[model samples]
Target: MSELETLNWQDWDSVLVVVAHPDDAEYGLSAAVKEWTDAGIEVSYLLLTHGEAGIQGLDSAETGPLRAAEQQTACDIVGVNNLTILDHPDSMLVYNLELRKEVAREIRIRKPNAVVLSNFEVEAYGGLNQADHRVAGLAGIDGTRDAANPWAQRELLDEGLQPWITSLIIITGHDEPTHTMDLNPESVAAGVASLEAHKRYLEALPHHPKPVEFIPEVLRTENGFAKTFRVFGV
Candidate 1:
């Protein structure tokens, strides 16, 4: 329980958020995203999967497009206009070289100073983390490095994307966070709205109660609603 450092969001001009599924960012990061976007920081989302296998009864064909739309709505609510959903299979993400390359390509193209990622650890304060989440987080870290190395992913260079080094990486939903971002009341409300945008998806989860209040409730702090992250530098 070391004192968490405060992240100066204004220091970075652009950030690219990489996550496993549709609602992943809305869980906690959306509050901070609201704060960042309000300050005119450019933000983009790179979702590895559409969370097609999230709903129990629905098949991939139905759930994929539905989840994608939900994610877009959620991002829009949080003021994120750039959202990209990759064709990676939901619930079957792997932290392999190919995945790293795909993520690196996005990093190169975006050239963000900071990258936000989901927790890669096996467990968080909430509970055991999912396989897809872990894979995506791990791949994001590797991709951050690969994006800076010209020889690492040569195909991206051939595609006219130049190598770019990211300055910071922030891992949300960490068990022990090193940095925190305090959110204003408006940011908290926006985060709630962002999660609520996933109406159909939230309805499908039997365990989720009061979906709109979920994020604000879980991430509330004494100062204000806050999001925490484990910071890494490149």
Candidate 2:
């Protein structure tokens, strides 16, 4: 087996996690994110949407701001102060050059050594993944390439965004994870708090599980609390 089959990178100073909506990271990755923050690593979250359409029966105009505020609070709980939310239409994301360019631009701006994203599989985590998730995941994967190649996203050059090659990519929710990192109780509790911070969104979600109960279960593994990932470019 290759060494990458058991990968663990501890030298990173900066990381950027890009996601499709609010609470995406908090679903399970927040515990790990909190651990990184505690280690003094710079972690920023770049959301592709405001999650305006996340709430049922609520107008997107209201839902957008509400979700944005909730996501902000969630970030604060996890020690992630730098949050960026794009205005891409909720539930209508497309994997196009426009999306790629936007993600690449953010990569250039953030200049993180590592980029984190979630599963992009058509069917993920025991259900069909959201369209925005697949699109956003592709944006993170391909956008990293676009950001690395000055010739790919030529428009970014005009905007003074330089090419940036991420040293690693960490993809959560892979069927065959390359690595698993243990999490402490403090970090897991922070994750629970972050998820709970989405008060309105969680309430609006149909039959949503309770954060205090749900987050801990999600983080549980055979041995102990942990987060798994499929690492690339390690």
Candidate 3:
């Protein structure tokens, strides 16, 4: 087995999953998340947007709330306790000071040892891997750094959120990956089931790019056995 495939991950105490939409975490990491939670690790979620722009037949006014509620349901299935939605407009998410400060504040509050996000460079998976995804990823990287900078969000510091940093980052859906989480047969099944919870959001309209069969296959091909990530310097 490759080093990433064999490395043990039972020591991590907390994990923060940051993704572009509501069901993104369930689609990619729910199985692994279950493993972490079962191991006593605190698992939290940070969804960058409501995916309001998604869905074909419905208007954004209607689709947004439906998608948001669907995402919340998915989180409940995975045993995620802390849920946060940036609520940024779907297709228009941008990388900026305001967004950066928001993400940084979450980092400071959670202090997760490991962070997970969609691959900024992925080309196959359409929506989750967008300009917004890259923007969110960059914000997360900088936020972890700025979390410790005394000047970066002094107001937050005053509230006692304090400076904190994640020790590692795990990026999904890359052609080449640096690490992998062994799913075991049960975990893999759980992951697949969790993805199924987003049934409505994935099958309804504009967002359902891939059918059911294709979804798992794509996940297995793009993010199976071992996932990939770039570790930022400490």
**Alpha-carbon local distance difference test for all models:** 0.88, 0.88, 0.71
Highest TM-score: give the candidate number.
Answer: 1
Tens digit of lDDT per residue, candidate 1, span 73-128?
98988889899999899989877899999999999878899999988788864788
Per-model TM values vs. the true structure? 0.96, 0.94, 0.85
Model 2 TM-score is 0.94
lDDT by residue (1-234, candidate 2, tens digit) is 233354454677788999999989988899898998888888999999999989989999999999999999999998897899998998998889988888888889988888999998899989998889899998889999999998998999999998998999889977778787888989999999999999988887668889899889988977779887888893
lDDT, residue 213, model 3: 53
RMSD of each: 1.2, 2.0, 3.4
**Candidate 3 RMSD to the correct structure:** 3.4
On TM-score, who's better, 1 or 2? 1
- Please state the error at residue 185 of candidate 3 in Å: 2.4
Off by over 4 Å in 3: 1-8, 122-129, 205-233
lDDT of 3 by residue, 76-110 (tens): 66677888998798878888878878877887888
Off by over 4 Å in 2: 1-7
* Clashes in predicted model 2: 0
